[model samples]
Structure formats: structure tokens, C-alpha cells
Target: MSVKIAVLGAGSWGTVLADLLANNGHEVRLWGNSAETAAEINDHHTNKHYLPDFKVSPKVVATLDLKSTLAGVQAILFVIPTAAMRIVAKQVAPILAETGAKPIIISATKGLEQNTHKRISQIIGDEFPAELAEGLVIFSGPSHAEDVATHDITSLTVASQNIGDAEWVQAIFMNDYFRLYTNDDMVGVELGGALKNVIAIGAGILHGLGYGDNTKAALITRGLAEISRLGIEMGANPLTFMGLSGIGDLIVTSTSVHSRNWRCGNALGQGQKLDDVLANMGQVVEGVGTAKAAHELAQQHHVEMPISESIYRVLYENANVQDEINKLMQRRGRREMDFQR
Candidate 1:
């Protein structure tokens, strides 16, 4: 059961996903903004700038023209950054309407919108009509592009408002090396995916400051609590935070050397300027922007998220990293509170 899938955005994640689909015997069109990257992927079957030294599947083709890429697609996967989701969705909606094609739209991007603080699926739903947007699915977990590209065993969750749609996504993405489980809690899944990045930044800061596993473990544990609190306030299931997209994603992103957010925060904790860290990374550090959105959302929802707020200040307010760390440690301790409250 091979499907023609169009994967929008050809960053490292997008390229690796497209390659994975191609390996699964599906025809994949990877849409990239850069004509040079498209040419490189098409002609040489390599995305050197992103997935350097890795040979992409020949079945995976790359193109700069969105219209051409969407011409005969059966399913659409949006893997672009959160900031670009709306603009790209707006562009795709008219074309999709004109083509009279209704594909199961899947979003793999994880982040809340800056000003609106909407989830990626909600942003897509706002741009596209109900027919195509209502069945949106979110694919996320602890899986990293670098690991998946190397055929490492990776597991993720495919969450949707509709169980059938989630199952459908699970079927396509599941394989020997890559496996997916279906979940109906889209809100929880998306929030868990988006919120964990802030904690990962904190973890990286700990690493940059030469802290050991004890400190990292404390941050990861407390970070999960903060994410779950805010997520519950925003109408998410508390149990979802205990699953793949929550603690699982948190562990990977916060500790993995491949995580852009961790790397960016590590550089920052080492006294590098934000501008310098971002400029040198050559990749989007989603947590930097997500931290701001999380801080705003926490304030609006009246949820106390000290860790996320501290990361936000360090990233945006020129707050000293060590000072914020000290403040977090010196905060008054309370009796062990129930997370399910």
C-alpha cells in the first residue's frame, strides 16, 4: 500500500522523514525553499547542507516549486518551523482548493505560535478549510533526525482528533526501524512536544555550566512537572505527559547532542551571545522562541512554571544564566504537591 506523499520543508528532519518514506516504498516529493538544496537532493540524492555525508534515497525527489510537488500528492506532511507554518499553510490552502485534492495533513513541527500561542495543528486548521484540516495528525516523540537517518530504532506517536486518522498515520510511518503508536489526545501530544524544548534548553545550560547527571536529572524531572501543569491548564490530559511525546521527548531533547535547542543553550551557558550562538548553529533552535510563548501562556493561564520562565528570561531578557539558576534553587520549597491537582 504505497502512497504518494509530499513532505513540505526539506530541513534535516524533513529530508530524513522523506527518505524514510521512500525506503518504505512510497513515492515522496520533498519540497524545499532553496533551489540549490532541491537540485542537490534531486541530482545527487544528498542534502549536504542539512544531512551531510548521508546518502538520501533515490526515490525521494526534491523540488522548489510547491505547486509541482503537490500536483499528485496523496498525503501532505508539514515539517517546517512553527513561525512559517501559517504563511506556508496560507499558500497551500488555495492550491489545495484549486486542485480539488484532500490529503490527510500531518504536522511534525513542534512549537506554539509566538503571539497567538496556538499549536501547529490549530494554526494549520485556521488556514485550511475544515474538510482538509479537521483530520490533522501530529507526529512527534523523542526521535531525532540524526539517529533516525542512521536506521536507529525510533518510536513516535501519531495523535489526531480522529482515531482512524491516527491509525492511518501509524500504518504509514511504522516499520522495522521506525515505529509509531496512535493516540487520540492531540492537545496533549502537541503540548508535550512543544513544551519539552524549553526544559531541554535548561538541561543544555546545565551541561554548559559543567553540571553532572544529578543536576540534569533534577531539571528534567521538575521540567516535566512544569510542562504538565501548563498543559493541563490549557485543557490537555495529564496522563499524556507521562507518555512518549512528553517525558520521552523531554529526555531526548534535553540530553541528546543532536538537539539544536540543547546545543544553542549550551553555547549560551558558556557565555556566548544569543546572536552568535544562533548564527553559528545553522539550524532553527525552536526552544528559544517556544520559551517566550510558554512564558506568555503560563502567565495567561495563571500557571506557575518557574523553569520555563527562567529559560525565557535567559533567552530574551539578557538575564544571567547562573543568576537564574541560583534563583531557581533558592526559591522557597513547598510540601510535595500532587501533579494531578
Candidate 2:
């Protein structure tokens, strides 16, 4: 049974997902923000702006018109950047409801909404009420666009407000190369997606410092602590942080050279400014936006995430990056093993 899947934001993530569905026998409609990009994808079957190396599926329809793309869409996979999530949602919700009927909206995006600190699901709930909107689902994990596009054996979690929602998503998204698991913990899944970027940056800084394997391992382990603490304060189940979405994502992002955020941080570690680093990077670095959101949330919730706080300061407050690193190393001493030790 072929399904109609609309993938919003023809960026790397969206392009990869659209290709995945199309290859799996589903009709995939890719909505790109720019007309030129859309035209290129429609004709060339490749997203020149993003996923250039991966040959797109001929079944994928890349379009400039959102409504036409959403026509008969059963599920919409959101691959928009974190900053644009709300804006895209607002524009998409009305058009989706009006274009025949809106599909079950699934956010594949990661990161807290800046300033407001809203999660992706919260943004969806606010923009599309349950009555008018299809039930929302979130798909996330250690999966990276580069690896996923290559048909790597990536595992992911599909979570929603309820377990049934997750189960519904798991059924459609699971495939041989991509293993999908269901989680009832939306906060945990969202937090895992959002917070891992921050840790990846930290890992990059450690790599910049020429730190050994011991230091990198420590950063990932402690980074999970930061996510768990902050997520719990924000109403997510504490245990969710220990699962695939949490520690799994952190390990992958922090270690992978393919991570945009890690690459950006590596540039920063080598003495590049934020703007210059971003300008040089060809793709979106999710952690850059995520650091700001984490900082704002830390202040609001009073969670002590020194590593996240340090990265936030270096990223936004004009604090010296190396100086912050030294400061983190010299923090009030305790045992390195347990939380609050």
C-alpha cells in the first residue's frame, strides 16, 4: 500500500527522508522554501543546495507550492531548521487544513525554540489544534542526515503525547536500514534531539584541545547528565534521558565528524568566530541555535548545566572560547563518576 508523504523543508534532512519514503514505494512530495531549489530538485532529482551527493528518487516531487505538495498528504515529516519551525508551522497549518485535509504532522526537527524555549511538539500543538490538526508525532535519534542518506543502519525513536501515537509512527517509518522504536516520552525524545547538538559542540572543543579518548568519553557521559537534569526540570520523564534518544544521540553527535554542530565547533575551536564558522559551513549546525535555547532554559529553570552554560556564553555572550574551556576544567572539584559527585 503506497502512502502519500509530504516532507517539509527540502534541506538535507528533509531531502533524505523524502528519498527514503519514495524509495520505499510511497509518493513523496518535497516542499522547498526557495523556488530555484525546488525547480532544481523537481528536474534534476537532487537537492543542489543541500543533499547533493545522494541521487534523489524520481518519485519525489520537489515543489515551491506548499498546498499542492500537501494534497492528500497522510503524514508530513518536518525537517525545517529549529529557528524556522514555528514560522513554517504557522504557514503550513492553514494551508494543510485547506488543501483537502491536513495529514498527521510528524516533526523530525530537533532543538528548543529560541527565546520562547518551546519544544517542537509544543510549537505544533500551538499552531494546529487537535480538532483541526492531525495527531502529531516526533521522529528522532542518533540518526544523521549524511549516514541516513547513505542507507546506514540507523535506529530512531518515534514518540508522541501517547504511546499509540508513537506506535502509529513506528509502523510507517520502520524499515530494514532504519529501525524505528516507539517511546511514550515526547519530552525525552525532543530533549534528546535538542540537547545533543550542544554536547557535540563541546565534544568538538575537546577535540580541538587535542584531548584523548578519556576526555571525549567524559564529555559525552556528563553531557547526558546535563540533558537529563534540564529535561526533568522541564517536565520530561527522567528515565527517558537514559534511553536511545538521550545517551544514544549524545554519543553519536559528539563523536561523528558528519555532525554539522560538531564541525562548526571544531572551526570555533581553531579560532573562528561564530559568524565566520557558520558562513563557512555548507549545512545547518543545529547546536548553535540549541545552545541559546538551553541557556535561556537554564536561567528559567535554574538547572546547573555548566558545560551547556559555557558553550552558550562562548557562542552568544562574546566570552573567549578557550577561556571558558579552562574555566570548565577548573570548576569546583568533585568525583568524576556520579551526578552531583
Question: Highest lDDT: which candidate?
Answer: 1
Worst 10 residues of 2 by lDDT: 332-341
TM-scores of the candidates are: 0.98, 0.94
Tens-place lDDT digits, model 1, residues 215-333? 99999998999999988888889899999999999999999999998998888878899999999999888998899999999889888898899999998899998899899989887
Q: Specify the highest-TM-score model's number.
A: 1
Q: Deviation in angstroms for 251 in model 2?
A: 1.2
Q: Compared with the true structure, what per-residue lDDT tens digits does model 2 show for residues 197-282?
A: 99999889778767779988888888888888888887789878877789888888999888888888787777778899898897
C-alpha lDDT of residue 253 in model 2: 90
Evaluated at residue 52, the lDDT of candidate 2 is 59
lDDT of each: 0.91, 0.83
